[model samples]
Target: MNVLRVAVSAALLLSNAFAAAVPSIKYCQNPRAVNTDYVGRDKNVLVQYTACDGVATTQIARAIEARQSNNVCGAPYNTSCFTPSGGGPDPNDCHVITDALLYDSQNIGALFTLDPAQNTSLITMTYQSCESFMVNQDNVALTYCRTDWASILDNLAFNCQATQNAHGGLSVATDQEWFIQVQHS
Candidate 1:
């Protein structure tokens, strides 16, 4: 059984990414078309028509591997995408879980708005968070995602009480602010 499993795993990885791997936690390549699209190699660009939470739109572009690539033209590839508690491999900003694609681009523009507070504020290289230790005594951590050229801030906020309890009863306050200077190439 172990031998069979190993062989299967190796074969899949071998057949996986012949082209440049997309900055995706998980992805499938389309072999027939330009070899890759939002859907898959040569697959139809599926879209789902749904109303936005508070925004309304009149049109959206046809779903396709954005031709004429430039800066920020490809899908948002954030390896540091979030995982909801207890959920496996949460789809971050640029990743799409199977069956999550829509039927068309008629309403996708509505999904493009950026909240100044949550989306625009810049982060430093040494960002800090205490929310995890504060709530469940879990240590806070930060990492960079080369996939999307983005910084991932996880478990923000601090709780001194939870930190002390989680770390052998030593009172430790998570610094409210920190820096994470990212050098883009």
Candidate 2:
């Protein structure tokens, strides 16, 4: 019994350490436009914000929390959703993403920045992931069977849109310079 207890305790410690190593990513929406119908389909206008700097991440979290509201909207397909909180054109909205393959940039060593014009590939990936999350919010098994595939595509269509529409009315020029990209040697 004592040996079993020790093994269980060791497992718990290892699990905690693994959890600690995982980064925390915050998903925040454009507060002004929690959900928008852009190009004839409704999409949750959200962004994935995170940082390598602990202080900056904490500050961003606080800023978002300060503006967060409990008001849930039955949106897209009558599902409950929360309002997005963030500063309008706020500096805190920008966070660093490490090990990113940025497009059209001379930088190397895996530094990625959100460039509205040049980072089309990364943007496409983000949109795809967001749509996946929206469609599988309940963690349901997705099927590609002929009859179900159409409905799945419809959900993806209704929930996904261009990222340009998600940025609280910020122009492309502004978004171009919004994030600070750094490549580490």
Candidate 3:
């Protein structure tokens, strides 16, 4: 009986140690536009935001929260969705747009900033419906500054527009596009 008790206690201690060593997994709904029929023929209009390397989903949520708190129509303009708390365009987070082609592909917006001192970078990409503006009707523009690429902004703009156009017209049959921008300092 004493040996049985000792074995059980050892098992419990080992289980507790293992549990303490495991990191928790958490998921947050991304604020980007998503397609309802992403898995089928009639795609809906909801997009999910994903985290980049060295960045956490919680950080992205915080950034969304920050942007939403400051502006009524912040990025990923999902009025019906909830914004993340304690994160928004801060120095520690990087943002990207997940669904830019659902509406007017030309109006997607994103911002990127890097702070070498803190070893952190922040990116905020907005996937909103583009208004009917005459100028630059087909082009989605973004400003980017990077150490390796002098024309990073131009590259980002080109990439964003191309991705948007690749969706082939905003319809139920099209797949979603993700426009990403990166900054290193």
Q: Which candidate number has the best lDDT?
A: 3
Give the candidates in order of lDDT, highest first: 3, 2, 1
Candidate 3, residue 29: lDDT: 17
List, residue by residue over 55-168, the lDDT tens digit for candidate 1: 212234311211211122122221111112221111221122111222112233212211111111111111111101011011112121222122121211111122322211
lDDT comparing candidate 2 with the true structure:
0.20
Ranked by TM-score, top first: 3, 1, 2
Compared with the true structure, all predictions reach lDDT values of 0.19, 0.20, 0.21
**Model 2 Cα lDDT, one tens digit per residue, 3-102:** 2232223223222211222112122111111122211012222223221222222465544543332211121222111113221122111111110112
In terms of TM-score, the best-performing candidate is: 3
- lDDT, model 1, position 38: 35
- Candidate 3: misplaced stretches above 4 Å? 1-113, 116-119, 125-150, 159-185
lDDT of 3 by residue, 3-64 (tens): 22322232232222112111111221121112111211123222221221333324655545
TM-score, model 2 to reference: 0.15
Q: In candidate 2, which residue pairs get closer than 3 Å at backbone N, Cα or C atoms, i.e. clash?
A: none
